[model samples]
Target: MTSSLHLPRRRRGLNRRQALAALGAACALAPGAADATPEAARKLLGDLVKVAPKAGKVKIDVPEIAENGNAVPVTVTVDSPMSPTDYVRAIHIIADRNPQPGVASFMLGPDNGKAEVQLRMRMAESQNVIVVAELSDGTAWTATREVKVTVGGCST
Candidate 1:
C-alpha cells in the first residue's frame, strides 16, 4: 500500500548536505528552536488559535512513569455521539514541561464514528499533558495527565 508519510517535503534546490546545512543554519537563527519552552508554547498556541475549554467528557491516557523520555505513548478519547449533529472537530495535545507545549493535533468528523486518537509523543522531561477537544457544536472539553520520565527527550 502506498501511504502518505505526512512529513515535510525537501526543498527543491538544496541537496542533502546543503539541506542539512541550511536547516542547521535556520535552526540557529530561530531562538529556542532546539529547545521549546512552555511559555514559547503558550505564545505559539495563542498565535495559532484561541480556545476556551471546559473540563470532563475527555480522557487522556499516558504512562504515569516513563522509563525512556524519547517516546511515550499517548491516547485521547472524547465522549461524543459521533453523529453529524454532535461530533468532535479536533484534538490538541500539550505537554506542560516540554520545551514545546504543543505535541500533536488531530481533526475528526462524523465519518470517524468515534472520538479517539493514539500517538507517540517525545518528551523533554517529566510533565503534565493536556488534551483539548473541540466539537462541531462550538464547545470544547479538556483533560490532563502527568507523566514522569527517567530521562528526557529532545536535544538530550
Candidate 2:
C-alpha cells in the first residue's frame, strides 16, 4: 500500500501589509474620520452605553501623572450590592487619545464578589480616561480622570 501524506492549507487572505493598507483605507473613508479627539470618544462612549447620566455608581483609579505611556495602570470600581437582584454587568475602559479609544471591556457576574477590575494599557497621549459601568437593572454610570503622559506611546 502507498503511503499518503497530507499538507496544511495556506490561509486564503490578505497578508500583513495588505491588511494594514485595507484598514487605513477603511478608516479614511469612515465617518467622523477627522474627529478622533477625546471629546468625541467620550460622546461615543455615552452613546454606546445608552445612558444619559445619574444612573449607577462608578469610579476610576489612575495616576495623575504617568512617567511612561506604554503601560499605565487603571482600575475601575463600581458601588453595587452584587446580589442576584442587582449586580454590575459590565465595565468599559476608554483611553481618549489612543488610536482605538476603546481600551478594555469586562463582563462581571454576582459570583465575582466585588465589582472591581484592574488592568494596564497603552495611552497615546495625555487625555481624559473614561470608565463606564453597567448594572443588571439596565442602568449605567460613568467616571473620568485626566492622565498626563510624559512620553507618547502611540506612533507620532
CA lDDT of each prediction against the hidden true structure: 0.77, 0.78
What is candidate 2's TM-score against the reference? 0.73
Sum up the clashes in candidate 2: 0
In candidate 1, stretches whose alpha carbon ends up further than 4 angstroms from where it belongs are: 1-37, 43-49
Task: Give every collision pair in model 2.
Answer: none
Per-residue lDDT tens digits for candidate 1, residues 1-156, read 123333233333346769779855653445554545557655655544466778898998889999888889988999999999999998888887665567888999999998999999888667788888888988888888889988767454
Best by lDDT: 2
Clashing pairs in 1: 36-99, 37-99
Q: In lDDT terms, how accurate is model 1? A: 0.77
Residue-wise lDDT of candidate 2 within 23-131, one digit each (tens)? Answer: 5566444454455577768777876688764644888889999878888898889999999889999888887766668888899999998999999988767888888
Per-candidate TM-scores read 0.72, 0.73
